[model samples]
Structure formats: structure tokens, C-alpha cells
Target chain A: MDILVCIKQVPDTKDIRLDPETNTLAREGVESIMNPFDRHALEEAVSLKEEHGGTVTALSMGPPQAETVLREALACGADNGVLISDRAFAGADTWATSYTLARAVETLGGFDLILCGKQAIDGDTAQVGPGLACRLDLPYVTCVQKTREVTADSIQVERMMDDGYDILRLPLPALLTVVKDINEPRVPSLKGKMKAKKAKIEALTAADIGAEKQFIGLAGSPTQVVNVFSPPPRGNRTMFSGTIEEQVSQLVEQLQPYL
Target chain B: MDYFLTEEQQMIVETARGITEEKIIPQRAELDEKNEFPTSILQDMAKADLFSIIVPEEFGGLGGGCLEIVLALEELARGCVGVATSFAASTLGIFPVLIAGSEELKERYLPDIAAGTKWAAFGLTESNAGSDASGIQTTAVLDGDEWVLNGTKQWITNGGEAKIYSIVALTDPSKGARGASIFVVEDGDPGFSYGKKENKMGIRSSATRELIMKDCRIPKNRLVGRRGTGFITVMKTLDVSRPGIAALGVGLGQAALDEAVPYAKQRVQFSRPIISFQAVLHILADMAIQIEAARAIVYAAARHIDSNPKNMSKASSMCKVFATDMAMKVTVDAVQVLGGYGYMKEYPVEKMMRDAKILQIYEGTNQIQRNVIGQELNKEYA
Candidate 1:
């Protein structure tokens, strides 16, 4: 089982600040961490490789500094790290990201499974995994909560739903965008850290991956984030002051139209 | 303020810091309150390869030196000295083996310690043998193929929980100080048991119990280094370990200062934030200055020990005195800065202050350290 885990290096959301004037995220000086959700994806991939047996490759598409997350992944158990980084991939929306990642995946072929987080913390956009699956024409599952069964040819998983969950099985060479409930990630061990320090990461460029000029970078994306800002604080209120039972009846009567 | 650590040293710091943030910090208060040992956290550290930092690579470790160990100690102590002390005491136990144990002994014990499957502890302090270490009454007599040990070791860190212990006892009482010999004893060995656990002022999460070895039997091969060289090994081990204790003080002082500055800025007293007052400002400034100075000496002392490894008692003692004393003063001021809130258990500064006192008292009391330094000065002048 050769697994490919797609990860992203995003500003640690804990310290993230919004630039009031620009209506955009102010990333300068904030620490960069592997997207929290992607860690679950990597954990799932590594565990699968551990239980069965094969190589686990950590794949990421971002700036050269994004190599940090790949090294972290390698430290956590990934056998190899492939970073697809190019200046041309700047300001890419979800559509362009999926395309660029698809091209990179095509370049690094023989993966029995590809894993990704349901969404990036910074963007909160959950479209890339499904879009890449569409591009590769592979069967895919999203919000994978548990992996019940696995074999060389296929895998059975529980897909989390709002109220319950759905059991689904997909054939080999599939894609999975996992939820955080998949598995707990392990800390990097000394042996693993030593290995990661000495290991060489393979880097792929835009041209090397054969990405077309019109369908890659910011120009390729159809969707645009026109503005990003926190919603205005609401200031409307209706007070119901009485005994517990009286307040409950009053609250219900005041909310009749909405109900 | 940068100590200019190498890449490998920085990695040790970062790895330990990760464990501190992810594991120790969250559980520190509860563990301290309950006085519970950080057994699970130690396991987490083992998984992180923290336990392997100072052991020889041949024995499944990184073979790191004093600087590396101190770096990790500072970070871990920042989260909780109780946990760091438990970790440091194990290294103290390991030192006897590393410094004097034969190839056979090292092969037998260091691997399990490095793996973190079995923790180690050092036992030397008895109720009667504290400041005057040579006064211990524990006896280990040879009986054909075995050695039988008797007497109690008081305030032994990691006492009951640690699987391995390296302890010193009298082998030939007539020889006085030279009569003591160090031996390795397993926890499950017959006739060896732990007495009552101590309720301490700080670092409550680390276990401290009496090691009671009543006619405890061990094979002759368990003797570390040579016969009757136990006192020498004890000195060398303390010489090697003092810098780590100093690092714990620096880390504790820094944690206290870290709490003080932000608190000063936010805590309102009078018309504005208390930091607006000169008295509060001065306290914060002093804490930062003292912590940085303490850190500098600890780094220098550790670096000196790692580079030369000889004639280090004076340098090691200097750091132990300076850093630990600095920690005591700084933690007190941090509490004063926090005022009534700092004295309360709700804030960590109170806990930090409690933890700071032990650093001054252990390894070598600040008074004992001054004596060592004074004696060294007389020798240098002579």
C-alpha cells in the first residue's frame, strides 16, 4: 500500500489576526503549523501503512517554506516527502489548488491511496479534495471517521454525517478526505527525527509537473474572494424577565414567527 | 540573549518544549494538586525519545552531553519542575552507571533506561546523611557470590516507581569515607521496599519516598565501577548533575517572569494597570534581568563541563548556587507582583514559587555550594 498524504502549512489559527484595512488575514509574524485537520489525514495514512505494509509519501503544494510540514510528516512516519512548489502557484483559489495538486499527483504516480484533510484551517474551504478526485477520476470518500476493513484491492470506512454516519467501501487507488475523528497523530520520535533530518525531499516544479499556463496559478481560478471580514456584531434583543416557567412561555411566544 | 545553540541542541530543546506544551502543562496543576506522579507524561517523553538524550548511542541513546541534557531540562522545567526533577533524578541514577559501570553493567541497564520502559533513580541521602553525605549508615556486606544491603535511604526521588536504582552503602566501615561502594538494585529484588512518601512544598508531582533495603541481596556483578569508589562516584555524579539542577532553576525563574510581565500589564490596582507603577515595573525588570543572568551562568557552566569534563566542581557549584538563589528571589518577587492572586493556588506563580525553594535546597544546598566554591578559591590561591 503506497499512500500519498496531502498537507498544507497554514498560519496557526490561534494567533491569526485580520487586517482591518485590507479585510484579509494578516499572516506576518504568525507561526505556521500543519493544518490541524491534515494531521489526522497523515495519521490515518501512516497507520494504514503500518498495519498493512508499504511506503507513505507526504505531498504538499505551496511555497518552498511549506517543506517544513513535509519534514514534520516524515518525522511522524512518512517514508518520503514530495513538495510541489513554484512561484507561479501564488494566490491560487480552491479550483486552481485542486488542478495544481492533480498535476503533481499525476507526476508522482503509483499511489494506492491518496489522503487529505476535509478542509484547511486558514481557508475553511472543503472543495480541493473532491475536485482533485474528480480530476483523477478516482472513487473518493469525505469525512471518513473510521476505517473498518482494508485489503490490497479495497477499503471500508465510516463516513460521518450530521446525525449519524454512513458505511462506504471504495476500491483501490482511492482518495479520502478524513475528519479529525480518524486517528490520533503520534509525536516525532528521536529515531524518526534523525531520519527526517538526514532524508532528502523531492521537489517538483510547475513545468516539471506539466501544468498548463492557463489552468494553474491565480489566473486559472474561476472563484475569487472579493472580501474577508468578520460579520458585524448583532445588537437586537427582547428581554423576558419572570419566573423560570413564565420566562420559558414568554420566550416561546416571542419566537412564534421564527418557529 | 541567545546562547547560540547548535542545530542538534536546538532540536533537543524543541522536542522537550513540545512535550512540555502538549503533555506536561495541561496536567501539571492537577498532578501537583493530587501529588500524583507524572507516569503517563514520562511515557510520552520516552516515546518522544527524550529519555534517550543523554545515554550513549551504543546503548540506544543519542549520546548527548551536559549541554543537551540541560537544554531539555530548562524547557521541561518551565512546564513543571516536578516532572523535570523526576526526569533529572533518573539521569542522576544513570550517571553512576555511565561514569563507572563496566561494559557488562552498562550493557545490562542503560538500554532499558534509554527505552524508557524502566525508569532509574539514585539513592544516597538518608535521614542522617544529608548535608554531611559521608555519615550514611547503610551497609552492604559481601556474602560469597552475593552482596546484602541494609538500611533506609530517605527522600529518594522516583523511589518506588523506578525499576532500577543505583545506591551507595558502606562496604568496609573501618575505611570511613573510602568504605562506601555503589550498587545497582532492582525494584523487585527480595527484601527491598519503599517506606512512606514525602509531602513536599513544591514539585509535588515527582515521587519522593524512602528506599528501604533490608538484607537486600544482589549479585556481585551489580557493583558499579570499583569496590569502595562509591564516594568518588557520588562526587563526580553531583559534579555532572549540578548544571542540570541549575537549568531547572533558570527555567522556573523564566516561567515566573513570563507570568509576571503579562500580569503586571493587565492587573489593575489604583487608577490604571499596576504596571504603570514604578515599583511593579522595577520588580518585572529585576526578574527579567536575574533570570537572564542565571540562564547565562547555567549555560556557561554546562558548556564548560561538556567541553572539559574535569575540575568542574567549582564552576558547577557556582551555577547551582547562583541560578537556584536567583530562582528563589525571582519567584518571590513574581508572587509579590501578582500580589494576593500570586499567593493563591489558582495562579501558577504560587506553584512556581513553591517549586523554586527545592532548587535552592537540593543537589547541594546554596550554603554547601558556597563552601565548595570557597574551598576551591583557597586551593587556587594557594
Candidate 2:
């Protein structure tokens, strides 16, 4: 089986800065780290590859610097790193990003499984994973907390919900957007780091992936961020401090409006 | 500060730093309070391949040298000197094996040590053999295919926890220093036993115990290298590890400074932040200056030992003396900077100060290192 893990490089949230003038992220000075959520996805992919014999390829779509995350993935046991980077792929929203990734996946050939984080920390818009799954027309599961089993033809996973979890068995060649509860990521080994340093990353451009000129980049995106700001603090708020049972009854009384 | 480390070197630092932050730092206070062993933290380090940094690549390691060990130790000591001491001492034990063990012995043990499955320890400093290692009373006698060892090894780091020990024993007491040999003693050997764990003033999380060998018997092949070269191997091991101890000094000093700066900035005394006061500010300045200087020399000494193995005594002793002394000063001053709060257990500087003292005392005391350096100078000038 060939497992593909999609990762995104985002600013280290601890040192985030927002450009006041443009209300956009201050990317120039921010340290870039692999998205925390994506680390779980990558870890899961590597773990799967380790348990069952397979090749794990780390796939990323961004600027050339994004190759660092790919390298980091390799150091954490990924067998290959494929970076789909091109200047033309800039300013892409989730829709355009997913389209470009799908095209890149198609160009890279077939994979038995594709894993992705539920959302990127910066964007927080989770459309890409499901959108990519829709584009590839594969059975997909979101917020997978655990993998019960993985066989040649099928995979059983526990999908997390607000109240409980659901067990779902999907056929092979499926897509999964995993949650942090899935696994803990490992620090890279010395041999893995050495291998990462020496390994050649296969870089693909938009043209290389056969992405259409109209359906890619910022121009192709239908949605745009009009403004970004913290909403003003609401004035009317009640603080509830008591034991759980007392707090719940108080909350119920306060919420006893239309009901 | 910018040592222009290669990418892989930076990765080692980053990984060690990650382990320090995520693993050691959080548990350091608890470990110190209880004088508990840091087995879980050590295992976390093992998982991160921290143990493999110094072991040769042929034995499932990264084939790094003194510099790599220094880099990792600096980061680790910054988090918890106790944890770092346990880690560095294990390497001290491994050095004898690497330097003197036969190929068959290396093959038998190096892989496991490299993989962090089995821990190693060096036993050179006995109660009587503090400065003059020749004073140790341990003796090993050849009996058929086995060598029987007797006497106790004092202050043995990783004593009971470690599986392998490279201990010095006199094979021919008449020849004095030249009469001794090094041998590998397994933990479960017939007469090998661990004594009471010592309650130390600092680095309390690290285990310090005694190895009591009462007619301990081991196969003759367990002998490390040729007979009568045990002290020679011991010197080489210290030559490699003194720089590591120096790096630990730099790390501990950096940690003290890390604790002090934030306190100085926020500590409002005399109607203003204490940092605004010249007296308080200058201490910070001196701390930074000395730490950087020590760090520069430690890095240089480590690289020197890596590239120049035979004649590292001068460089090694210089660093071990300077860095460790610098740590003692900085950590004490860090406590001074914190003033009343610094002396309190709520702050880490008091602990840092305590940890700093051992860096100068152990791994060859500063005075002894100065003596070694002076002796080297005499040899050069003669």
C-alpha cells in the first residue's frame, strides 16, 4: 500500500503577529512549523506504513520553503517527499487549494490511502480535506480518533463526535482527515534525519500537475476575505460559578427562554 | 551564539531541546523534590535517539563525536542538570567500552547501548581513589576462564539501573598504577551487588550508589582491552567527557540566566523594575558574558577533542575548569539577582545554584583540572 500524507506549513502560533495596516498575517518574521494537526496525520501515515509494509510519501503544496516540512516528514519516517510548489498557486483559498492538490495527486499516480489534518491552524477552514476527497471520488472519514483495523481491502476507524464516537469501516483507497486524538507524533531519529538530508524531493509545478489556468490561484477562488478583526467583547454576559449540578441548573434557568 | 552548525547538528540541538521542554523541564521540580530517578525521561531521550549521538554508526548510531554530545548535553542541562548528568555519565561509562573493549565485546554490547536498550556506566572514582585513581583497592584475579573481582566502587552513577559496567580493578598490585585492568561486569553477576543510594545536595534526581563486588566472577573475555592499560583508558575517557561536563556547565549557566532575566525585568523594587538598577543589570550582563565565553570555549574544546584525540588534555582541562567555574558564579549570582525570591524553592535558581556546584566538583574538580593544565604547560615548556 502507498500512503500519502498531506501537510501544510503554518506560522508558529506562539509567535504570531498580524500586520495592522493590511490586517493580514505577518508571515515574513514568523517561524514556520508543520501544522500541529497535520503532524498527527503524518504520524498516523508513518505508523500505518510501519505496521503494514508500505511506502509513506509526504505531500505538500506551497512555496519552495514548504519543502522543509516535507523534509521533516521524511525525518519522522516518511519514505518520500513530494512538494507541489509554484508561484502561480499563490493566494489560494480552500477550494482552489483542494483543486490544486487533487491535480497534484493525480499527477503523482495512485495511492492506497490519503490522510490529512481536519483543518489548518491559520485557515481553520476545513473544506480542503473533504473537497479533495470529493474531487478524488473516494470514500472519506473525518475526525478519525482511532484506527481499529486496516486490511488489504478495508479500514475500520472510530470517528469522533461531540457526545460520542462512531465506528465506521470504509473500503480501500479511502481518505481520512484525522484529529489530534489519533496519535502522538514522534521526534525524528538520527538515521531518519540523515536520510531526509540526503533524500531528493520531487518538486512539481502547476503545469507539471496539469492544473487549469482558470481553476487555480487567487483569481479562481470564489470566496475572499473582506475583513479580519477580533469581534468586540459583548457587554451582557453572566458568570456562573458553582458546583457542576448547581451550575447546570443555573445554566438551565438562564437558558429557559423559548423552551 | 551562532556556531554555524550544520543542518544535522541543528537538528540534534532542536530534538534535544524539544525533549528538554516537553519532557525534562516539566518533571524536573518533582524529580528533584522526591529525589526520584528520571527513568521515564531517560527513556524519552532514548526514543529520540539521544543515546545514539556518540556511539559509532556501525553500531546503530549517528557516528557523531564529542561536539554532537556537547550540543545535546547543552540543551538537556538547560532543562534539568540532573537528567543531563545521568545521560552524560552513561556516555562516560560507554567511553571505556568504545576505547578499550575488544571488537567482540563491542559487537556484543555497543549495539544495545546505541539502541538505548541497555545503559552503561564507568567506575573509576572510589571513596579512596578520589583524585589519585591509583588508590582504588578493587582487585581482580584470574581463575581459569573467569576473573574474580572484589571490593566496592563508590559513587557509581547508574549503579543498579545500568546493565553494563566498565570498572577498574588491579590485576597485578605490585606494578601499582600500571598493574590495573578494566573489565565489563554484568548487573546480575554472581557477586555483584548495589549498595545504598546516596542522597546528594544537587542533581538529586540522578542515582548515585555503590557497586559492591564480593568475589564477582565474569568470563575472561569481558576484559576491556589489554591488561595494565585501565588507567590509560580512563584518562582518554575523561579527556572525551570533561568537555561534555563543560558543555553541561554552559547549559546550566544558560538555564540560570534564563531564570534570572525574566525575574529581573518584572521584579519591581525601589519603585522601578530591579533591572533598571545598575547593580542588578550589571550582574545580568556579566552572567551573559561569562556564559557566552564559556560556551564558545566548550564548543571549541569539544571540537578539538573530536578532531585531536591524543592531546586534548590541555584544551579539555581548560574548558572543564572555565565553564564549570563560570556556572557556579552565574547560578549564585542568579540567586542574588532574584534576592529573597531566588533563595526560595518557588524559584529554580536555588536549584540551579546547587546543581552548578557539582559541575565544578565532579568530573575532575576545578582545582584538579587546573593542575592537569599546569602539568601540561610544564611538559610543553620543559
Candidate 3:
């Protein structure tokens, strides 16, 4: 089986700060890490490759610095890496980003499986995985909690639901968006790190992939962010301070307004 | 000029964190309560190639740098400070040998340690010599073809369980600290025994005992470095080990803060989450600042040791002093944030506080660290 895992390089959320003036993410001097959810997806892909005997390729679409995530993926056991980066790809919304990624995947040739995280923490718009699948016209599964079985013809997975879970089988050449419930990613071994340091990532631009310029970035994006603001402060809460019985009476009195 | 950790260092942290969370944390309280030596955990750590961390790959080890070891210790401490303490001490005890031992000694000893088949202990302090190691009365007299060691080493981490010991004894009683010598004594040597285990306030899971040596005989070949170099070796070893201890402190502190942040967010005090209160938020913010500062110093010390081993004593001392004290304060504040629930043993912050206290006391007291910094500063002025 041939696997392609899409990962994103994100700011370490613990230190992430927003620019109040422009409603943009502050990236200066901020440390970048592979998105935590994407780590699970990469782990799943590596595990599948380990069990079934195949090559795993990590692909990402971002700035030139996005190669960091590919190197990280390689260190974590991916056999090959590709970086889709270009200034023309800036300011991409989910639709345009997925469209460009779908074309890039086509340029990279065929694969048995394509894996991605359920959502990126920075955006949280979980549309890319399914959108890419729609563009590729392939069977796609989202919120995959576990991979039950995989073969050349089809794959079975446990998909997470609101109440419980559902197991589904999709044909080969499927796309999957995984949750944190997937397998824990393995740390790179010393040998794996040395290999990653030496591995060359195949870099592609929008034009290199023969992507239509109109459907590439901000100009091609259908949705635009008009405004972003923090939510308003909540109303003050009443405190009931006293002994248990007195507090109960106070709580009941406060609840009377809602009732 | 990369300011962040190398890829290998990052991998080491990840691997160490995984092993620690999965294997060590669950057994921490049990091991402490039972006064059990974590032989199984040690075995698992060995399986994860932890023992080979500091040993050079040419010598059949992973060749991890000081930063890597610090990272591993940080993760391990997050699981259990005591277990991390013991594991780190073993590495500490063996470093002098790896650094200054003869080729024959290195070949004979390092392989077993690297393989995790044997554990090592450093014997420097005695009943009378806690911070003032130069005051130790342990004596090693050169006799014919062997050295006769007679003394008691107190508060020795991994004391009773270690198979190998690097002991510092007075070789020339007339020369004070200059007279000290380091010797390698294998376990089960004649007249070598261990006292009862120590009952401690924290890090109780790690075995700490008094090593008693009476006429303990070892071949002259076991003499490490020169006759009067033990004091220097011990001090140098501490320079490396202190960062590890600081890293442990930082990890424990972060664990406390990590727990407190979420707890404050979810815990309701008066119809709203405690985190919504300015006082609580301020405390959390302060704790975060302290932890980050401690982390910076700790990593800086590790980097100093790796980049320039000759001038790291001051950096290491500073890291140890600041990080440990920060841990004590942060853990206590974590307990405060939890209110009455924090005092209960059911909450991890209490244990974390208990564990944090030792960092201020061990690997040389914060006062001693201050002295080191002062002396280094004065030397620069002079």
C-alpha cells in the first residue's frame, strides 16, 4: 500500500498570540510544531505501513518553512516528503487550499490511502480533508477514531459519532480525517533522524502542479473573513454564601428567576 | 543559528515522555508506599535505550548529549520524581568513569552500564559531610596491589541497589579536599554493606541508603583518574547532574501548573470558575512566568554543558538554584489554587509539592548554589 499523510505546521498553541490590529495570527518568533491531531494521522499512516509493508509519504501545503513539518514526518517514520509551497498560495481559504492540495496529490501520482487530521487548531474549519476528497472524487471518511482493517481493495474504520461510534468500510483509494483517538505517534529513532536530515523534500509550486491560477489562493477563495472579535463578557453570577441549608435557600431563590 | 532543540533532542523528549506516562506514573505511588526499588521500570527504561543516553555510540551507547539526558529526566520526573532521581543518579555516578576512567576501565565497565545490566552509584557525602564534602572522613589507604576503603556514605541515591559505586575517599589525609580520591568499588566486595533504607519526606520511591564500607578491597586498577582528583571529579559530576535535577524540578512544577490551570478553569468557587477571578488568574500567570523562566535557565544550562563543558559550573548551579526554588513555590501555589482539595492525598498537587521541596535541598542546597555563583562572580572580578 502507498500512503500519503497531510500534515500542517502550526504555532505551539501554548504560546500562540493573536494580532489585535489585523485579526491575524502572530507568527514572529513563535515556535512551530506539527499539529497535534495531524500527529495522530501520521502515526496511523506509519503504523499501517509498518504492518502492511509499503511506503509512506508526507505532504503539506504552506510557506517554504512548511518543509519543517515534512522533515518532522520523515523523522517520525515517513519514507518520503513533499512540500507544496508558493507565494501565490497565500491567503487560501479551505476550498482553494483543498483544491490546490488535490491537484498536488494528482501530481504525486497514485496512492492507496490519504490521511489528514480532523481539523487544524488555528482554523478549526474541518473542511479541507473532505473538500479534497470531493475534488479528488474519492471515498472519504471523517472523524476516524480507529482503523480496523486495511487491504488493497477496501478499508474498515471506526468513525466517531456524537453519541457513540459507527464502523464503515470504504473502497481503496480513500481519504481519512483522523481524531486524537488514533494511535499515538512514535518518536523518531536516532537512525530515523539521521535519515530525515538527509532526505530531500520534493517542493512544488501552484504553477508546477499545473493548478489553475484563478482557483489557487485568495482570489479563488469563495469565503472571506469580514470580522473577528472576542465574545462579550458573560453576565455576573450570584453567589450564595452560607451554611448548606441557607445556601440551598439562596440557590433556590436565584433559580426562581430562571424558573 | 537554531535557538530550539535539535531533532534528536526533540525525539528523546517525546520517547522519554511516552515511556514515563505509560510505564512510570502508574507505579509511582505503589513503589513509594511499598519502598520498592523500581527494577521493572529500570528494565523498561533500559529497553527504551535510556541507559545508553550519555555514553558515546562508539562505545556501544546512544551518544546523547547533556540536553537529551535533561529532557529524559524532565519527562521521567513528571511521572515520578523519585524514580527519575534514582535513574538520573545512576547516570551521574557513571559519568566520572566515562569522562576520566582509563581505556581498560571504560571498556570493562561502560558496556554493562550502557546495556543496563549494572547500575552505578556515586559515594561522596558522609554522616558529617552533607554540603561540605571536603569534610568527609572516608579513608582509602593504598596497600600493596589494592586500595582499602573504610567509611560510610550517607544519603546515597540508588545506594543499596547499585552494582557499582564510585566512592570518594581521603587518599592523603594531610591535604584536605586536595587529598580526596575516587575509586570504583563493585557490589559485594569484602566488608561492603548498606544500612537500612531512609524514610524520606519525598522521593521515597527512590532507594536512598547509607553505604558502609569497612576494609572494602578493590584492585589498584579501579582507581579513577589520579590519587587526589576525586574532589574535582565529584564537583564536575555535579555540574552535569545539577541540570538534570533542575530539569526534574521544572517538570514537577510544570505538572503542578498544568493541573492547576485546567482545574481553575473548570472548578467553580462562587457561581463562576475560579479562573475567572483576577486573583486566581494572577497567581496562574505568575506560576506560568516562573515555570517558563525556569525552563529557559534549565535549557540554557544544558546547552552550556553541551557546548562548553569547561565553563558550565556557574550556569548549572544557577539553573539548579532557580528551578528548584521555583518548583517549590509553584507546587505550593498549585495546592493553594486547589484550596482544601489540594491538601488531600487524592490530589496529585500535594505529592508534587512534597516532591518539589527536595529539589531545593538536594544536589547541593540552594544556598550552596548561591555560594558557587558568588565565587564564580568574584573570580571574574578578580
- Please provide TM-scores, in order, for all candidate models, with all chains considered together: 0.91, 0.91, 0.64
Candidate 3: tens digits of C-alpha lDDT, residues B1-382: 2438877777677767866876887888777777778988887677556788888887778898788899999888888898898899899889889878888889988888888889999888888999898999999998999999999999999998999899999999999999998999988999899996888888888889999999999999999998899888888889988999999988998888888999999999789999999999999999999988988999888988989656888999999999999999999999999989999876788888888888999879999999999999999999
**Complex DockQ, candidate 1:** 0.50
* 1 or 3, greater by TM-score: 1
lDDT per residue for candidate 1 within A60-150, as digits (tens), equals 9989999999999998899999999898988889899999999999999999999999999999989999999999999999999998799
lDDT of 2 by residue, A96-209 (tens): 999999999898877999999999999899889999999999999999999888899999999999999999999989999999999867777666787888999999999999
lDDT of model number 1 = 0.92
Give me the candidate number with maximum TM-score.
1
Candidates sorted by DockQ, best first: 1, 2, 3
What TM-score does chain A of model 2 get? 0.91
RMSD of each: 3.8, 3.9, 8.2
Query: How far does residue B162 in candidate 1 sit from its true spot (Å)?
Result: 1.7
Better of 1 and 2 by DockQ: 1
The prediction achieving the highest DockQ against the true structure is 1
Candidate 3 lDDT score at position B156:
93
Q: List the DockQ of the predictions in order.
A: 0.50, 0.40, 0.10
Between candidates 1 and 2, the one scoring higher on TM-score is: 1
Q: Model 2, residue B101: displacement in angstroms?
A: 1.9
Q: How large a fraction of the reference contact set does each model reproduce?
A: 0.37, 0.37, 0.07
